[model samples]
Target: MLNILRYLKKHVGMAVLILALLCVQAYCDLTLPKYTSDIVDVGIQQSGVERVTPNQMRDTTLEALTLFLSNEDEALLRRAYAIEDGTARLTVSDSATLDRLDQALSMPMVALYQMGQQGMEPSVLIQQSEQVGVDRETFKTQLRTQIETMADQYGAAADTMTSQMAILFVRQEYQALGVDLDALQQTYLLTTGGKMLALTLLMVAAAITAGMLASRVAASVGMELRSQVFRKVVSFGSAEIDRFSTASLITRSTNDIQQIQMVVVMLLRLVLYAPIIGIGGIVRVATTRTGMGWIIGVAVGVLLALIVVLMTVAMPKFKKMQTLIDRVNLVSREILTGLNVIRAFSREEYEEKRFDKANRDLMGTQLFTNRTMSMMMPAMMLIMNGISVLIVWAGAHGVDLGTMQVGDMIAFITYTMQIVMAFLMISVVSIMLPRAGVSAKRIQEVLDTPVSIHDPAPDKNRDESKGDWRGEVCFEDVSFRYPDAQADVLEHISFTARPGETTAIIGSTGSGKSTLLNLIPRFFDVSYGRITIDGVDIRDLSLHKLHNLLGYVPQKGVLFSGTIESNLKFGGADITDAAMTQAAAIAQADDFIQAKPEGYQSPIAQGGSNVSGGQKQRLSIARAIAKQPKVYLFDDSFSALDYKTDAALRRALSQQVKDAAVIIVAQRISTILHAQQIVVLDEGKVAGIGTHEELMASCPTYQEIARSQLSDAELGGAGA
Candidate 1:
């Protein structure tokens, strides 16, 4: 989580501001509950000094506005008539009347007594004069009715506000405050209830503002971290990629970042609020000076228990959910990639069964996690109610002893409730932390992986290779192995292919031809000895320099989801129209490409699934030819083409790439029989290296392979 936070400076300030807002709001919300407790304790229980016929007060305020407006309108009409007769007075008594009316109507309904002051504001008398030019009864009658209606409405407002504050109103002890205190309490209940409720709402608005701000901050920071992780993953080479695949990386970047974001924002709102409630409850308790230690103790105990339960039950479930996500992704990928195979085998039911098992497993894990987290809410409520009951019992005894005032006892009970609620909030944190922890761990794994390919030293000389890699290849005692494999896939081997020569590798199966060829591009570093191009050790030169000097068409004929032109131009960005036409002609692929509905602009599905294997292979060969590389390695690239096309392609490529060296790895001996050199392999060892005539005369392995494939006619043709 802290690691994720390190990237927050770019966009974290907004999140921080939001958190601050939510915290401020939450504090206000906390204060309202406490304030209502004060209102009930001091005004409702102890005194009636707090007084209002709320509707009458409202009506008075409205009537004040109505009277002022009526007088002003009449004064305006009189001024219009006077102006017409050129008898208007600039300093009329109407001004004085309007001033007096404005003062009365605009007096704000705020708590003067709570501000440590008391009583009504100074009175303002509005003087109705002849200049006003309005009927006095008309103003008085309208203002009176408006005042009456406002009074009725204010009463309902005050009544409803007080009732809603019931949760914060401490259980009463009316007898203890005596008559004056009791009257004051009654007056407060009637007049100040709405004021307290409104204050509570102000606090709530602040809290909501804080929650929204904090969530946005979390989201913003999460987004930055997601980008950071993705950039790192993108730069990682094949080795690092193998450790965390495409699906897992995607999950970590999105879901894990979201998890962390939520936790941070939630922490800002809820954590900040908890402390205010907790501290306020404590202060209220200590000020009341009552001994309700048992109630507090029980509340704390319940909180700790809930926390423990959440950690024990929900923690593992959180971890389990992340694992289930990986399984679900794997199933989805399988269904997509193997759609054809599944259909061919008529196993849609089998795939569905596989998916169902994975889906159910994920559901079960997530369901368990949700259930455990949810248990905290109800458990919290139960504990809170129990604390409330205990407080009433304890406060009642304190009330009887005269050691606690009725008002004080009420306030203490309010504080006791706050403590329970605060503790319940702490319990909610327990639920959130577990899931976030699991997600954090998952994210950390990707960040920690070391990129497999290390950059070479800057000081390494460029002249280490010979002749712009003019394809003078040599393998001197070369060996190679996979990362996880126990044994080498290729043993000691030695061979060379000079410029304009064709070197072909042949084996029955499981031969290291492709693996050996892959090393030339420095795709995998050699395990033993050295491989050279034009007498240059392949690794000494930069990977870019080495790869650009050669063209490789792999056995699979890789193509992206784009048009044929785009895939062909992938090898050389600067390829021209003439070059594309020439390369396609050389590979014998121009006819098919031209025949397509959109010709070279025709869309190819991912992996060239839209084209036949032969067409895809031809396009791949064409792409390599477009590069005009000094050397070309064809790893069984012609396997998909018919014998006639393959023969034609080989002949055309030989003439076009006459000056460039070519290495061919083939399963069919006929494909490479005319090569300058043919290397035969059995298992991981090189069996023979010679020309076709020399291999047929001297190498038993080569002769046996040749005899098995030939018939009387073909054998006789070769002899002739």
Candidate 2:
């Protein structure tokens, strides 16, 4: 989660904007419940009653009492509202003054209480009205007459009072003036409904805007991650690539990045929005003063417990799921690449089962995590519905005692649902987050692995105008071994190949032919001794200078997907068409390339799948030739060509590449028999180094290799 946050910090400003929009959406959604409660409680249920505030009650009572009371009585009545320690006291000198002030203050209180109990039966009404010692019937009848007189004097302004005096005054005005209460209720409902509809629309717009921003930010994050991961993978040398296989790297760059992208979208849209709704729902419910608040807490606790349990069970599976995906990709890639062999060997069913095993492993882990998450919705629903039932059950008693209104009870249920729904949203996103976090850690692993190969200090790097280093390569007691190998693959090897010379290394199988050639280009640094160009150690050269001086062709020729022209120009973008043609001609690829309708413009499939092995090898050699480097290292490049094409290509290379040091690794002894220098290797040790005739006379390893591939006449001519 912290790693995910670090990536999000790159776009903090946009994330803040998304949060602001989501908050606006949540506010608009939460506001609707309050308006809904108002529509029910005030607009419809209390349409005929006046809701007078304390200020209105005080002002109206003062107006009515001014004509009858003295200044002292007025002061005493005003002090009745200013209660000390919860008791309202009027400072009156005599019974007359005290009675007058009491009458003035009691009028509004009695009117307000009577107005509130209007819908009750007579028995209930008598008990609920103010506790003055008057007969119920006479009190009610006189109360109505006094309220009408007050209304006639005060006019319509009497309806604004919160006290019972103002309520009775408003009731008297409505009855006498013949106003329709039902019509008033309808008008208020329509106004409240219109406001609710407006808010809902605004909420919808904000939600749409938030979704768009989330998608944009998530996609940008995915793109950025892919770019960085790809660049990092490209910079990795053999050691790093070996640490993480090709299939796993592909999964990390593609599948893992997609996982993080989806989670980012959910993080912005659902995860972030959940807290605002959850906390805001809590605040809204609290302000409504609903007595059933504990139900929401209970539901959240149940949800949290379920989430914790499911995560504990499913977290391990999520981590293993990615490795299974890598296995599937690895198996699938192997089957596809080896399809012909699999078919030839009649192992179709076996291969099918092999693939199915990998597929089933992935399926099993996915099923576990998905099935665990699936339980959440049904469980949350049970909690939600159960909470709803509890709220209604508890709230019904409040309604019976008139402690809570029907509308307030309904709003409480809605807010409770919102709170639980918020938790539900978070739980759903949380399930995905753990998986994405696993993927993020995997991606971070790739980005964090250091490259094995690095350049020397700037001062120690190679210079262009230094000695005759242009085409000279020297191996001084060089030895190398794989990372975990028990012994060296190449041991105590020393040799030098100078300009205008073809120094061919001839060895039988497993003699470290390719490994020895790879050292000159710094593909793998030597384990024992140093290799040099001219008189300077190869490690002292910057990678750019080192690679720029050598043209290396691997044992297996690989091509990218593009036109032939693009493939040739890949080594150097500045290679001219004439240079490309000359390189192709020297590699003997010009004939085949020109045979195609488009020649150099012909399209090649990935890995040169469109071309034959020999054509691919020729194009690979042509690509290296186009670079025109000072040294050429060919690792079994001629193994794919026929003897005739091989002879012609080597002849052309010998004449055209006179100034470059050429090192060839070949299994065929006939190919290197005419070279100026021949180094024979036997089991990673240098058996002999001399011309072909001298080696055949003195070295048994070279004689054995030469006698196996050549006729007596051919060996004799080579010895001449």
Candidate 3:
């Protein structure tokens, strides 16, 4: 996982931004519970008030208010209500308006008139109540109602005296109607609900922002990973390509990279969020004195145990799943490429069974991991619900004993659920971790592989500018063995193909014909001795310099998906139209290409599947011809053409490539019958090297090959 994160190092700022935004989201979520608790306990139960009301000092209510009123509470009232000399006073009456006393409501109303001058906050009266002589509960109920009455009449623009007088009379009027208490509770609900709604909207906005940023980062990482892997894969030589097969490399670059990308998004969205909610929930729930903290602890313990068990069972399978996927792709590619041969041989059922076996193996591993992961959510939910029930049961006693409020207990349950949910989210992401980690490791494997065929060291690199390559290719006792083979595929063999000449290699099947041609281009280095071009060891020459002087067409005649002209000009970026047409004419591809409706613009399907095998071979030859290299290597490139087309193409090529070295690996005796030099290989060694006539006379291996494909009269004519 850490290795995978190295790809994301460039986006550290974005990651930090996501973290900050997630913290904001978590704050909004965590804060909402407190508001809910406040609405229940403080908003509803306390009537959203902080001061005593005039109704509480009425003769009908004085007996109840005195019970919970402590000495400090009395002192606060005396200061806030202007109660002096054992009698509440009303100072708001004008100096000339003392006659209004008869209509001034009551003594409580008169005392409230001095609220502003007393400079007393309303909450102090309610908080300092330790000296109350009556039952605390009864006094608290009346005081809450009295405070609500004052809050009701405290209009936005009302002065202190007018608001106090209005509150006193309103309470008296409401008592007559018997509905003020319910109206106050409804107002508390509406105020608390509005604030909660706004906070909830803020949380949704923050969550959306975090999600978009995380998705962008994940997509960027995936793009970078695919690009990196592709660049590395393109540089790999035969040895590296064989070490990690084509199918596996495709899986790593596509499927494996995608897996890592998905996991990264999940980590950014959920992993970062879980910790804040988890720790914050712990702190919030811990402060509640309901004795239900143990339930959260137990739930977490069970969750961890479940995670351990599931991980233990699924981790190994996750590793195997990728390998199985590779196998399925490999088998499928082989079957698809060989569909014709399979049908010709009537092996459809056999191929089907082979594919089914691979598919079944992949299915089994996937099923195990998926089933294991699927079980997790349900079990986690069970634990969460069970903990909720347990908290409510255990906290019921605290609420009954007055040690905990019902609101506090409800909030504690919410916090506990958050804690459990945080862990649950972590566990869900954990399920993806093992599989994605396996994928990350696979992707890194390809990116980290050292190119087996790299450029020579600076000190050893040949200076191409000093001497021009005269297109002289020499094999000095070269031998090559496969990595694990006990014997060499090509033995100690020596030859030279000089400029202005044709050198043809004729060998029986498995006689190292294609292998010998591959060595010239450094597709695989010789195990012993050196192969040189223009008197310089090919290894000492930079790859770019060496390949620039040679044009090679592989035996299979591979072509990419593009226009006919695009395929011809593949490596020759500066090739002109005249040069392209001339090369096509020389390779005998001009006739067929001109016959197509689009001519050079005709599109070639992938692998040249749209063209006939012979046409593909001719186009492959033309592509090499278009490069105009100093040396041309045709590795059995003419096998698909008929005798007439092959003869015409060779004759045309000889006239155009007069000053270049031409090396041909051919199976037909007629193909190399008129070469300037012919080398006959028996097994891995050169049986004979000479003209066609000379080899037929001196080399028995050459004679047998010629006699098998040629009449005695034809052989005699060639030797004559």
Candidate 4:
């Protein structure tokens, strides 16, 4: 996965932007619970009275409440309020000052209010104290001392109990002062609700924007990866392609890349964001002072354990799943490509069974992994609900005992769930990471493979030193072996195919005929010796220049989907109509091409499946001819043509391309009987290099091959 992340370097700017947006989203989401707690505690419970200090109160009520305060607190309370027209209004607007006053006045105010509720109001107490011969100032001091002692007994919970009681007293004072409690509650609810709505909107926007950017980055990475893989594959020699196989490469290019793309999105969105939310939730819960942090710890531990178990059980299957998919793709490609052969052999049922077995293997592995991974969501939900239940059970006791409020308990639950969900999101992405990690390694494998064949570094001086180019290909003691092979496939081969002549190679099956031709184009480099063109080693030339100097037609007559004109002009856009017509004429394809309704404009199906085998071969030959290269290599290209067409085409080619070197790999004796040179091979070694007459008299391999295809009369006449 980290290897694949190199592709993201190109999109670093966008990825950073996504990370920033995810942070904003986490902030907004984490803030919402705080406001929710406020709505429950301050809005409904206290009738929108957020502070213990009343904004307005009657002068008599203020004076009576202040009696329970110490001299210092009483003086501070008087300074914060102004008595005018028998009503006192809070004069201080600074929030810090108001908060200080709320702390100082809460216990005294709550103690007096509770006494009043039990029929001992401050005014009643003063009257009864005078009746019992107690002075007002002494009575006030005694009352203040008793309230301080009670607060001392409450310890750390004093603030919470005092704040709750003070809010009740503030509500009663607001009612006594004719304040519209309904309007106040409505305003507070609307303000807090409005902030929550704004945060929600902000969260939604950030999430949407972050999601879009993440998708773009993932898509761009996927595109760049696909392009790199394709260009790398295109540069690969036969050795690398054989090592990876076409089916596996296809899966890597498509399925494997898709896995990386998906994981990148999750990495941007969830993986980066989960830690922020989880840590932020932990911080928020700490401030709530609910002392329920243990619940979150337990939930996280369980989640970790569950994730480990599931990943362990499913990881091997995830790795196996990719291989199974490759197998399925391999089987499917083979069946489709060989459908005709399979039917010809009446093996459709057998092929179906083969396909079914691959499909079921893939399905069975997927089912096992899917079933194992499927346990995660239920188990996660179970953990989450269990945590919620535990919090509610413990928090209910705290609420009953007055150590925690209903709103505080609710907020604690929200934060706990947030923390759990954070882990859940990470676990989900982790589950996908194993498969994606496999995919990343697969893709990186293709990208990292070294091409067995490479172009030489440029040298303008060396390039200019080579005089005029006249095609002269020579193989000097060339011994070739495929990669990892124990023995050479072609050994000690020496030959020259010079300009203005035809050199033909003939061999029994598996005689390295095609391999010899492939070396000229540097599809595979020679193992022991060198091949040269114009006295310069072919490897010294860049691939583009080397390929441009030779026209190659493969044995299979492969054609891309296009019209006759397109196929004929495939050599380059510079190929003119006249050149295309001339090449087609020389290949004996113009006659049938003119018979078609659209002639050169006719559409060709993929792989030229719409054309006959003979026509496809001729069109391929025509394409090569249109290039007007210095050398021509025909690898059994004439096998599809009948005797008449082959003879005419050869005759025309001999005349038209007389100045160019022509090398033909032929199976038919009639095809190379009149060649200027014939190289016959028995196995990997050259058996003979001579004219047909010279070979028939000297080489038994040539004589056997000639006599097998020709009667005595034909052989005599040809030799003569």
Candidate 5:
């Protein structure tokens, strides 16, 4: 996973933008619950009277309420209100002054409002004080002292009750002032609802923009990772390719990279946002003071435990899923490529079973992991609903006891769900992370594998311009061993093929004939000794310069999807129509190419599957001939052609390629009977190096190979 994150360095700017957008989205989403509580508390319950300090009141009412306040609070309230005719209008609008006045008057307002509910008006109280032989100011002082003593006895509960009753008093004052109560309620609801709508839309916009930017970053990372893997694989030697199979490499490039892309989007969208919502919800819930914070703690703890158990059970299966997918792909490719061979052997049922086994293994692992992860949603819903029920049950007591308002209870429920949902989002991503981590490691493996074959540095490479540039390839005591092999496949091999000579290597099966020819191109570097071109080691020449001087044709012909003309001109972009036609004629492919309806424009399917074996070989030969390189290496390139076509091709090749060395690796003795030199191999060591006539006279391995394919009369004729 850390290796995969390195790709994100190139996209840091976009990542930061995504994070900022997520923060905005989180802020908007979190604030909506506060307005929801306000719409219920202020809009519906208080008759839209939000302030405990009444906005307007009659002068008699203001003076009556001030009777319960200290001298300083009375002076502050007198200054905060302005008298006009018989009414006092609140002149202070700032929250600080209103809150201070509200604090000063809340208990007094609640005490007076309770007395009025019992049918005792302030006039009645003044008459009672006169009956008791006390002045009105002294009676007011005694009433204020009684209210303060009762509030101190009730502690925090009195504060909550005081605020509720004070709002009721403010509502009655508004009615007395002839304000429209219904209009004020409607205005508060509409205003709060509008703010909620705006916040919701803003949250939606932030979410969409963040999602789009995250997807773009993920897609860019996927593209770059695929390119890097492809270039790395292209530079791999034969040994490196063999180390990681083709099917595994394909899975890594496509399926594994796709996994990383999906996780990247999730990481950007949820990983940063979940914590913001969760922690912010916790803070807001604490402020609600409903004493139900333990419910949220319990829900989050259970959610975490559930997530840990599910991931623990599914992680190993996630690891195995990618390998099983590789197996399925490998089996499918093998059956498709060898379909004809399977049918010829009457092994269709066996092949079907082979494919089914691979497919079932993959399917079974996927099903188990899916079933395990499937339990998460229902379990989360259970936890959420269960906690919700618990909150409502406990919150009902607080509401009945007059400590918590209905709107506060509703807000608490919302915040509890928000906290639970945040954990759920994080848990979902946690489950995905293990699988994506497995995929990241798989992709990283291909990128991190060291290439066994490397080109020389520019200063160390051979300069072809400084030399005569004749293609003289020499293997000087060359020995090669496959990676981790017990012994060398080619031992003490020494040979030289001049620019104007035909040097053919003929050996029985398992004698490293193709392996030896591959050495000239450095497909696998020599382990013990060096092969040189113009006295410069092949390794000392950059791959580009070395391949430019040599044309190679493998035993199995390979062609890409294009027209016949395209395949023939594949050797170099500078190859012309004349050169393509001449080269095709020399390789005896012109007859077939011209006979086709499209001729040079004839389309070839992928891997040349549309063409026959012999036609593919001829086209392969023509492609090399069109290059006109100084040396040509053919590794059993003529096995598919008939005797007549092969003989004609060799004759034309010798005439046209007199100044370039040609090396052929062949299984048939007749293919190289007339060569300028033939190298014979018994095991790994060369047994003879001479003309065919000279080899039949002196070398047993050459005599055995020649007698196996030729009649006594033909052999004697060749010797003569």
Candidate 6:
């Protein structure tokens, strides 16, 4: 959670602004119930059933007594309203503003009560001193006198202000009103008009601005964090990436990040506001001056208990839902990647059943999670209504006993709802939290993995390699091992090939030939010994410098979905048309390539699916040749070609180059019969290092492999 906070802090201003708005909204929310209490107890009920003049109404009643009330003459009020009988502004404009203003007033009054309890206010001290027969009105009279004395010094006496307010209130009267009613309307407007409008507008505008900015900031933080995670993904090696699958990691990056983002956005809008709501509920319950109002506390307690229960039930289930999403993603991926295999085997029914099982499992888990999490809302509503019933039951007795007004009951109900809803929102957030937190932890783990390889700093301590087209290659006791493998694949392998020499390695399967060849290009670092190009160790050479010196055609050829021209350009990124044609001819691929409808411009499907395996291998070889590297490692590159094409490629190659080292790994003796040297291997060890005849005569393993593939004539032809 702290990690998420740090990430979200990048958008702190937006978050803070949104939080500030929610606080304002909460202020309005808290004020409303108390205002309902005041409006019923003071405005409509206390001073009703009177046709007294507006001046008398103002002098006698508390509603008319408050300074910030608004009332209009019949005509102007009608014109300000529309024929449709609604404010011309959007609907939310009026209701939300009115709602918030009521909440604001409720807070200050609650604060007054709280201050008295804390022994920290004139009002609280006065109420305490009431024990000595100092009544509430006595303190009011004393406080009023003190204010009047201060006002005289400042030329602001209370009676003078009252007389001025009376004259001033009457002057702003609507022209259409009779004097008696007009005075009353004017007094209401004088007190509450500007303050109510300003407070409502400020709270509403702040709430809206805050919501918008917080959502934007959350999204921005999510984007930056996601990009950072992706950047880290690029640096991880195969071993590290295997800890999480492609689908799982992708889900963590996209969906998991988004979940955490929503948590951030909701927390900004709710956590601070929730506490305020709870406090307001406490204050309202505590300050209920009415008879038997203790039931409000019981109702409030039950609501809180329900929220805690729902969160506890829902959190773990939500976590399972996230894991299920990853599994669903994995299942769908496997089905798609193996679609062709499934169809060819006529197992659509089986695969469909497999997909259905995974799909249903996902649906079941999510349904459980949704049901559990959604229980919070209904559970909250039930608790709210249950408490409202209790409050009504208690308030009825208070009303009967002349201690509580009907509006007090209504206001108590409203305050209870707000408090419960705020907790309900918090509960939903609580449910979302554990799942998103788990996901955040998962993403962080991937980002924290260390990169295996890094370049040494440019200094004399590191060997520097610089060359152009020197084809000398050497392996001195070179042993290459995979991470955590039981043994080295290549052991104590000492060999060298000079420029213009064709060195062929012939061995049975699993003889470490491919692994040994992989060492030259630095695809994997040699585990035990040094492999060098010319006299420079491969590891000491920078990757860019080292890779520029050799061309490797992988055993399994791969092609991107693009034109043949584009795929070949990957070799050097700038091969000329002439060079491409020359490379194709040398690779014995020119005939079939020209046979295609678009020739060099022909589109190659992904993995060269549009072409035959032989054609794909040939194109791969052509791509390798186009680079014009000093050394070319062709690992089982000719396995797909027929004898004729194979013979032609070698013939073209021999004539085309005399200053490049060529190492070929093949299963056929005929493939390397004319090579300058051959290294035979058995298991992971080198068996014999000699020419074909020398090996045939001296090494039985080499001789036996040759006999299986060739007759006496071909075996003797190897030494011809």
Kindly list the per-residue Cα lDDT of model 3 for residues 1-720, writing each as its tens digit: 886678789999999999999999999899899888878765665554312243223332332234334454434444433444433433343333332322223323333333423753223443444456755666565655665465455433223333334344435434543546567767768887898999899999999999999999999999999999998998888888999999999999989989999999999999999999999999888776566777888988999999999989989998899999999999999999999999999999999999999999999999988898899989988998899888888878766544566788879989988999899989988888878999999988998888878889999999554466679999999999977789999999899999989999989999998889998888888899999888889999888888988999888889999999999998768999988999999999999999999999999999999999999999999999999999999999999999999999989999988989999999998999889999888898999999988887788889889989999788876543
For model 1, the run of ten residues with the poorest summed lDDT: 167-176
* Alpha carbon lDDT at 624, candidate 6: 83
What lDDT tens digits, residue by residue, belong to model 1 across residues 1-720? Answer: 465455456655675576566556645654565556656555654344322111112222222223434456544433322232222222334556444422333212221111113333212213441226767667566555654454455453333223222212111111211224444456667666776767677776876676666666777778777877887886676656777777777788887778888777766767656776787677667765676766787778878877897888777777788778888887888899889999999999999999999999999988888787778778877877777777777777755644454555666666777777776766676576667777888887777776555445777646453454567888999998877889998999888877899999987678787888877776677789898877777766776777788899999989999998998889867899888889999899999988988998999998889998889999999999999998899999999999999989989999888888899998887888789999998777899998877887777777778878866465554432
- Superposed model 2: Cα runs more than 4 Å off: 48-50, 53-187, 463-469, 717-720
For model 1, what is the C-alpha lDDT against the true structure? Answer: 0.70
Give the backbone clash total of model 6.
Answer: 11
How far residue 115's Cα lies from its native spot in candidate 2, in Å, is: 7.9
Give the alpha carbon lDDT tens digit for every residue of 1-720 in model 6. 776777776776766667667778777766656655544543454222111112111111122112122223222222322333211211223555434433322222232323434655433343454567766555544544544454455342332233223333332221212344444444444333444566678778867777777778778878887898898876555555666789888888988898878887787776656887777766775665554445655665776677677767766777777788888888888888788998999988998898798788879878887877667667777787877788888778766644556876787777767767766767777777787788788778777777654444676223444535487999898777787888877788899988899999878899888878877776566788898788777777766666777777878777889998888777776788888899899988888889888998999887788888888898888888888888888898999989999999989988765689999999888899888889998887889998877887788788889889999777765533
Supply the global lDDT for candidate 2: 0.81
Please list the C-alpha lDDT of all candidates, in the order they appear: 0.70, 0.81, 0.81, 0.90, 0.90, 0.69
- Worst 10-residue lDDT window for candidate 4 reads 458-467
Better of 2 and 3 by lDDT: 2
Q: What TM-score, to 2 decimals, does candidate 4 have?
A: 0.96
Task: Show where candidate 6 strays beyond 4 Å.
Answer: 28-208, 243-247, 269-326, 345-357, 399-402, 405-409, 457-471, 497-499, 521-523, 571-612, 648-658, 717-720
Worst 10 residues of 6 by lDDT: 49-58
Each prediction's TM-score versus the true structure:
0.71, 0.85, 0.83, 0.96, 0.96, 0.72
RMSD of 2: 8.2
How many clashes show up in model 4? Answer: 0
